[model samples]
Target: MSDGPRLPGVEREADEDRIVCHVDADCFYASCERLREPELREEPLVVGMGYEEGETIGAVATASYEAREFGVESAQAISTALERLPRRAAFEDGTLDDPDLEREDTGYYRPVDMDYYESVAADVREILHDCAGVVREVSIDEAYLDVTERTAWEVADGFARHIRDRIRREVGVTVSVGVAPTMSAAKIASDFDKPDGLTVVEPGNVREFLAPLEVDLLHGVGPVTARELREMGLETAGDVAAADPEPLVERFGERGRELYDRARGEDDRRIEPKGDPKSFSRESAFAEPVEEPDPKYDLIETLADAVADRARREGALYRTIGVKAVTPPYDVNTRERSLPGPIDDRDLVDRIARDLFAEFEREPVRKLGVRVANLEFATADQTSLAGWESAVESDPEPDSESEPETGSERESGAEPGLESDPDPDPDSEPDPASGDRLVGQTSLADFS
Candidate 1:
């Protein structure tokens, strides 16, 4: 999130306005599958996690709209989804005619292929960069673009249509776009029509556009908050918008004010193009939590190499090397070692990450992560560690016995990286923090 577009020492107008567009790919993972095998376009598809060679259970990552009709949904256990939508193979030998098969539709299951989807996402992002002066990539399948200076409100719809058409023509995936005066409104409008839909809310219509919608449709209003709002007799955005500000503020603190403002279409957050990241991290989760040291160390080695490779590609260096371990039931612990100055030493990253992660060797670890932070972009130099003892003394290690926090326990914000889907795939597990991009203030619009 940026404070609008501003140069150094320049004052921004208090009433500055901009045209923001939120573009979201439709059922991205499923769409990618259809792209690969066009025969599956009409077939119900379910992409799952943990579906390897001898696994009875996995989790649903994404389901095609057809699959959703069968009550299959993202994040539901694979076993449950299978019960609702039987595998296509079940019907291959004339089993579809069986009276005992309650399901009317059979579905295909594919393991999540993150690398392939990422490659597709990169193509989409390239087009976004060309379409706007500033583009904020929220996740692999969604982004926000500031096109205020590029096009007027009258032509914004046409502008959006052009983008949608191009993506379909070039990338083979249809995208829904919402064009509005604010990011929140844009997000809602984009989802207002989905699967290659487009909706534009003119400047003055923001309030009316949001007023009749359910409160849960608003950004950051999750199930718990929606329930609370309904319990308070605030059923729609209109209710929140018209309620007394003081009571709402007192009840929800600063967030209440944000809710009120958003209901009234008052978001002023800018479309900040992701700049240099504060850190580089790579993570992988186990199919099942492992308590052994060798497997965990092997994962650490792979992650360290990945992060360091990314840093080298960006011509960046770091002074801190850190490792993260997530114990069973989602407890997260992080440890880091900081040097006096930044250095892009790959071996050093590997060694330090392993040293930091050594304490968690015997713990029931569900996930592992390696991060290099305190970044600087300068040429590498051989610097002596004469001051290493003092540096270590100044920055004491964290308590090794402390209970780790879950991913949700940490602060939420947009991190600089190619946003990956939160859902894990069997072959390529995602970082526990991977899906944070999809949940918070900057998430893709949730039409449902």
Candidate 2:
């Protein structure tokens, strides 16, 4: 009944269970920069914030292990990083800083040019598409592959190695991959060694692999959630696994059940593909916020093209257009417009996307996105707008102007037309620097 492979290194099973692999590009942003310039391969590199080297307001986008040696880390504010490493001046040269640009107090900081990174991410995704049977992209740097048909874990490691080498040679980035019986388990494994680590978690070893890790390592647990779990004396995945579900439910509500399932390595979530992503969005956070229209428009054009490509690949069409703009510190803004009906017109998507983007006008934006909301599978019966079923019962307009939904929610976790609910914000920008998880409220099958 199970599609899991029968091979060594994979968990022994008596029943149906799926073999899933989670592939995550290591130090995605920093790695992408290294690809652009081969010389920085082993150098101490940190990508985050704006050009200023000493400012901590902006978080670390990614730090090469070399940088990590000096305590530089992703998500840690850049200002705080200066205390650990020397500072360096920025290069607006539209090129990697000259090796000579180094300074004592100002360590090296690379401004995030998502346009370059997005292109590299696409190449990596292409490698995954070639290797996977059922591929589901989780982020620009992360994805889930169902390799059940083509390979087994005994050989999965080799597959991962080949993919890794290809990504490095062809895509110019290294990735860490984890293979396991379930998606959650594989995700945890992928993060184990990091920066080109290859970890495989067998089904039988799932519990063993997860037991010693802190509760926060579980997919859904965050700082706040972990803190609350700790108050109940639950520190490790094992602790949470052993706790009574009712009490957890009483304390954290729905999240409690989710925690319990993850603790027990019971994730039933599938590698559901978004038949075609209605919208593809990429946001670049800068230390110094940007309000310039020309520059922002350029970036929007780049992102719009990528989204169009994804829609084309998935055979999906869109009619609604939207965008999200985040102003420094923590202000999230969003806007959306609906089309006449489902249409696969990329130029139209681009034109409408840009039109919607005009609203941002000159607003300072630390992050920005482009979205096509009224989605319909391109392969579906082509019909006029009046004949199609709506994704939601209400109007197709985005329920509210908020940050894009989280990646998870965008695929199938968020409830349509119910943006204010507890569902995860799927469209929100994913922090490659930080493994931030956002799940929308919807069924996986809906998107697939």
Candidate 3:
């Protein structure tokens, strides 16, 4: 790594030669089933919820390759999958309707064995961690590995095969591995050939490799977006890449530009692990920009209550309460107050949010939001105001007919940093200290 002088607020450049590897297990749940019951291998197996040897009531979780031949798919209704492929157990004992049903046409049905599958996934996860310097597990069965530090492009395919072989040999399950210079391309490459497949897209060949795929094949492009893209005459990745970007942007905002970029092999994202959320917030847009105080404050109070409830449910204590008010012409103005210490006080969250947003209550606001930040999560055993970290809110339940708090309940003296909070301006400085820890605060009100 170069010892370059790093400045605050400057974006870091993406490494062009970085190798990203996407590993996805082949029919993970069914594969796990086959691990214990070796007889289920290459057999038509269906793993789902509310499904037993004789009963069928819930949804399908996963269908093996053999089962999928008869139109079985994930998230499909259990009854629907059963209609296409009746349960083999019922057919064998002369129970299923229509006695002429062949044994080959029928399939095995198993309920979701999450605990066993998780154990199998843990073994696979260990192998992935050992193979790469950085791993981003997208789900239980698939992950992205940053192998740039581990292997070179010249032998990338062989390195990918080694990872695949390790999982299959050690864990008794097959995995498809895709290696590429970019994350988007790597993701597409992984699904190129399913069921124990491996594909590698070198540095310059990412675009060509992605060209022939359909629009929905790209990550984040779902059924609705793909249909819209099709209406715009962009049926394939190449179509989107070659079309005018102006129309695309008008249709889908920033995501349209992202689709165009990914179609052209222009993703700069690096592999990073998912982490705990920094803050929790909830917001709502008004039917029209309301200049009235009552409607605006009502929304703010509602949002504050919701945000606080979320924090309490998640076992988090917050030290900051904030409000967002979007004024006319799409300008987002925000204000927040930091407390002396973290507290799971719902009333306090509402109090501070309304106090901070008092200036914008009468202003023409198009949207309103409430947020709580500077969080400290507690364990399951610890939950209280003073000592325990895991305290659920102990507030009295409000009657359905009770009117909302309109700043009349607050006592004279206010919490420190809550009163006389400065608005964001060119000359003003943000409040950097809340309690023992540094608070990165932002207030957008008035210095005038």
TM-score of each: 0.60, 0.58, 0.59
Give the better candidate number (1 or 3) by lDDT: 1
lDDT tens digits by residue: candidate 1, 313-405: 667877788887867554557788777666666777787788888888988987687877777776655343343545645884553333454
lDDT of each: 0.70, 0.63, 0.69
Writing each residue's lDDT as its tens digit, candidate 3 over 203-322 gives: 898888888999888765766788889999999999999989989999988778988998999998878755544566776667778998999888888988887887786688877677
Colliding residue pairs in candidate 3: 382-389, 382-390, 383-390, 383-391, 423-445
What C-alpha lDDT, on a 0 to 100 scale, does residue 37 get in candidate 1? 71
lDDT of 1 at 345: 68
Candidate 3 lowest-lDDT run of ten: 407-416
Q: What lDDT tens digits, residue by residue, belong to model 2 across residues 259-343? A: 7987888887777675654344444444566888888888778767766666666667776666666554334566777655776
Q: What is the lDDT of residue 58 in candidate 3?
A: 62
Candidate 1 least-lDDT 10 residues: 407-416
